[model samples]
Target chain A: MFSASVGLSRNWEPFDAGEEIVINTLEKLEGEPKFFLLFPTIHFEKNNGFQKLLDGVFSQLNRSTPLLGCSVAGFINPKGCYTRGVTSLAIADPDMQVTIALGKNAKKTPQKAAEEFANMIKKEKSKNNSGVLFLILPGSTLPKDIFHRTRRISNPLLSSLFDKFFPLYLALSKEGVAKESEFIDKLYSRISEKMIGISAWDNNLGFSNYQFFGNRVLQNSAVGLYLSFSGEITIKYATPLKIFSEKLRVTKKDNSNYLINEINGLNAPDLFFKELKLEKKYLTEELLRKITLGFPISAYCGNIFFNRVIGLYSDKFLGLTTALNTPEIYISTASGSSIINSFDKVTDGGEKTNFVFGVSCAVLLEEVGSKIFEVKNILEKKQIKNFLFLFGGSEHFMTEVTPISSQESSVTTFF
Target chain B: MSEETMLSVLEDLLKEEDVLAIMLARKNEISVSPPPDKFKLKNPSIFSLLQSTMNEFFVVIEKFSSQGLDKIYFELGEYELMFFLIGGDTALVSIIPALANKGLLEVEMENARLKIRELIQKGV
Candidate 1:
């Protein structure tokens, strides 16, 4: 029957405003929360000031405290939203238990390590204690090459991505170049067949809710912990809805620059512009627009799969990623209904969990918008009190949102 | 030996029938005289070629010769390929493109071989 009430007061002080924001939060949480998680909203593009803010925040935290957090797209609180921000979840679960296990940087497998840790929980703890594992994997560790076959099929201009989006890029392959313009047109017709399909998802953050916690940029790689505990863990995720009317892919890229191309003949950033049908090119194409790489996660063929706008490329036709040939992207047409549904279908549950920790995508701040209040209202309907959420990449394979589960959430070991 | 034993041995070598299928080649003379239906690899010489490519063959030299290893792993560069040996002359080989974590799989195979040896020696 405990309540989570957040008070927000934005700071306008030009110098170290971020520090004030977190300091105020610490003061509010001073009365030792049954268990409090601290997540400082980090906006590094803001660079300079972020450092002092982090140092100050870190100084205040108990080094022994397990903080389940990440680099965010934005943050949320009662104060509304912004790209540069942070937030924390304070809990009071007298019956709760949690712990965090650090994975060997790039050496050991996250799953095996987490499972070993999960098994380490005291066998004497009434054998009925259920827990979750929350993983915060490093985003840079990804597999070598799944799309090596694509190198043989080339459009010359768009062959580089043959390494990642391999299965679908075969549409533009040529038996032998026949007619020039006609063949080019035929190529576009063929490209339409090359639809984006989700390959294996790496959400083995040890808990069931592997869907939450990373960015589209964080897709190829991952990190986090497995959360195991001693009972019933509660959790869910949410995202706004929109559908694509036009689509594009970046077939060729070099760093940020991409030679964007697509199956429909739409070139460069125009495909996104046309897909959204928004006239202002400046707003849609801007680098800092905080555009959510909206993806749809649905059940297909009895397995969970994600469909989304993978990432953004530069604003050049040759570097047309933002302009053209990026991988598959979805254009939002309408909003989703379950202001609470995205978070509804969680990873399959079995172990009993009395508490959980959540690390959410920074972008959820935008997608949830004012509706975050509505989502919170929905949560108020539940009795889940021990929980924490921080803004960062969706953490796994989600385009817009990711949440670490109790199994993946990091907390000091308490059986 | 027995057809049952041969089939079991062949199945052990092939792993799965999905992609790579190991087939036995019947020697010509044997086929004509006894309908031998024998088996040999099309490219046994590839092993010789590999040995020559490396300028030396690392044969029975063992970490513990008395213990006798049930398996040995070879790392072929360029391809980073791996091949394993089991039961003396019988060899389990794989090309990189068609292989997955051969070194790791070799450990499991060795464990299985050791157990089989134990069962045989124990009259089980």
Candidate 2:
């Protein structure tokens, strides 16, 4: 009852690429799709004309079909994770009931905005309880608003730090009563009992160019899409980081994601370098990658080790790719071999999936470097018919019960 | 790492017998020390509700301080909540029991803040 096609095209010309992708996708689909999900790389979004081009191509394809899109850091098609291009999935299913609500204004609390959007969907379609919903928002980070009232600092270094740290804080604050996760919890609390689904973070993928379009809403809004299927849908996440160090607690932290004031009782950067047995004097890009591979921060929930990666480092702090407010954290690491093993583990069950959607960490590609293609080839070998991978700075996949984000993992939704 | 030292400090502070729960907030977040499930607050939802409202308060305060504001206090019946702006965006929040000595708790909170600041200043 449900069928979809994945399309990807890399014409640097944004307008031409948009039309070409749509045409190629339509060729592969059996009939007109009721919904189309667009995922374009951050570079594609940087071209100011991309949005108009998207509107033109999307409307031309089918005015009746609703279009939902977000800027992505990177996206995946059958070919694997590509740094550039547009990747999309078109879905046409008569049994699925769909409803969408949008929340505008970047300054509003993400939690409140999501709640309003979810409430609207719930109010309109309270009768249907069997489907899933996808909450799509612009990528987590945005360029620091120098003009904003909160950021009036005049010093360029301080301004740059504030700009970078503020958005990262919003993205990485997951545990406790934090910004990003708080919004997620509020939204989830509103509709978790009635429906099942996940929230997708789309920004210029990893670039700060965050935008989302759906219904009457444009950029700077949280868009909630409600989907009810006559058939069943199963969802699960794949966490790839393996813990390598003993558990330690986050004793202190600053408001920004870039700086950890303290971990355990020692200064964070000191403890980080000390534990790795690496000298600060010899720090290099290769060493940084190796350290990132070996020392991801993992939070213990029940018995599971939920991991977060530190991609950026300075004398001040260790930058967390995934948000955390939990007091306890452990050192975690990922390797090319381990990631491949995780891919095999996730896909080995043979679920006879009609479609498998992958959301992977951009850090994995950074750490693995050119070896990403090897992992891609492994994914390609999967017996499952259709699989698309999306690579971003961070990846979030959630069900009603367990919602988490990771830097070295892949969360795949099987349909 | 330094978890032991900080936990010991928190342990010493909690030994005051009147401190029921201690929490930390950075920006719009509130994290209960000893974890919420273990320490158990009477109404956790109240903290979340207030956190959202306090965000507005922060927005207004930003207009006054280019460097950001430092420290705020609140009294609700028998409870006390102390908020300290540390490391710019981070807030060190502490909740004290009604029967505890307010003056003593404030001093302890300052001590913890100073130690945290020292750790940050001595970055690797």
Candidate 3:
């Protein structure tokens, strides 16, 4: 359905190093690209070179084609994974129509902003009637205004009191997460027919950095790229976490899954360590990544086991990526071997020999270390040509009219 | 009590052949039992889609009050969208395949609604 070429460059001395590779990517393409999707690493963000490099590429393209990209921790391509270079995927498909929309001021009303962006593109004409909407959302926190609006407690005093005790409540509230999810939901609901592509997260640049880009404008927004394809497309995703034999019941927890005092009738943190068999001194970033990305609570739904990634951990309580909240109980454990096995399982089949784009969990790179290269080798052996991968904080995919957030998982769509 | 009741109800819904997906949303936030992975409604927009559908349907319902229509039903190709207000900002949404027995589905939904009501009344 498409032809794509990828280019990478570690030289950032002249600020044109990345652009040189980008130009080479376009030259390598069989035909004129409809659009360009750039995934540049944090190294490009140094010395304010991200924008400079973006401008350089824009100047080279001369505004002839649409450019959309996000700042990523790292990226992967047909060759291998890269941490210090720019990975540009130039897609050339005459049968596919692409629309790029940026939702400005996403920090304020992420849901609404995203809806507007999706709506704008949906209003345009799609060639094939069958396409995919690939979303790139910001990883940073929503604006405080959105949080306050979410509270909706009405009584300022009551809300303040709740906030005083649970300071992170407003920030990590399930409601806040739901709002973002709802935004993606609404977008999909508006256009249910389009196969939703893997949604990538731009490394949270906090409030200062420009998180997303469309054309030449860098802004805090959700960028939705609508690609209408005339041919066939397939998608495969792997959460890469499995439940251990032992099951742990949540004996007690707050409204959010953050403050869990006990699990399986024992201290939460103690149970976590005992079940995983880890030493306290070895709780480094590497191990933490393995746990958060590899070990996820298993929840049974239909015939599949969906793994929920853990967000934070402390001596007192354990946190989860999303608030599974009250009445949700499950067992979870992390093993590098299990994660590697799960990756192999998920990547079993359904891959096409044509164009492919994937977004892998950035944290997984820190955890599995060398296994990532093995994964690349597997893909290479599979002979997946013209493929690009983005390593980021979170990966997004939509199915059945909703967007699902996954960690330690790689989402790849084949066209 | 509330969690168990809701979870059990959802589990029951899964047994139905036509129930492609079932989810519950409270104040626009989805609290689906068995999680999104099970029903495959993991799309973040599913809640908003249901919420918006209900919101728009209610507006139409309020406008056509004279017709005495107490329920809303809609279809999208092969999927049947149905929902019942389970009281207090909560709505149970079910996406069923068109081939399913609609009558039987309604009966199951009503029974589930009653259980949810009991939980609400008991403050569980």
CA lDDT of A318 in candidate 2?
66
lDDT of 1 at A335: 42
Give the C-alpha lDDT of model 3. 0.60
> TM-score of every model?
0.39, 0.65, 0.63
lDDT of 1 at B12: 47
- Can you list the residue pairs that collide in candidate 3? A185-B44, A185-B45, A186-B45, A301-B38, A402-B43, A402-B44, A403-B43, A403-B44
How many steric overlaps are in each model, in order?
A: 79, 14, 8
In order, the TM-score of chain B in each prediction is 0.37, 0.66, 0.70
DockQ of each: 0.01, 0.01, 0.01
Candidate 3 lDDT tens digits, B44-83: 4654566556555545545654665434467765567776
At residue A319, candidate 2 shows an lDDT of 58
- Structural similarity of chain A in candidate 1, as TM-score: 0.47
Local accuracy of candidate 2 as per-residue lDDT tens digits, A164-202: 565554554432112345455666677663232222333
User: Per-residue lDDT tens digits of candidate 3, residues A201-232?
Assistant: 33322112234464453544677678886665
Docking class of 3: incorrect
What C-alpha lDDT, on a 0 to 100 scale, does residue A118 get in candidate 3?
Answer: 67
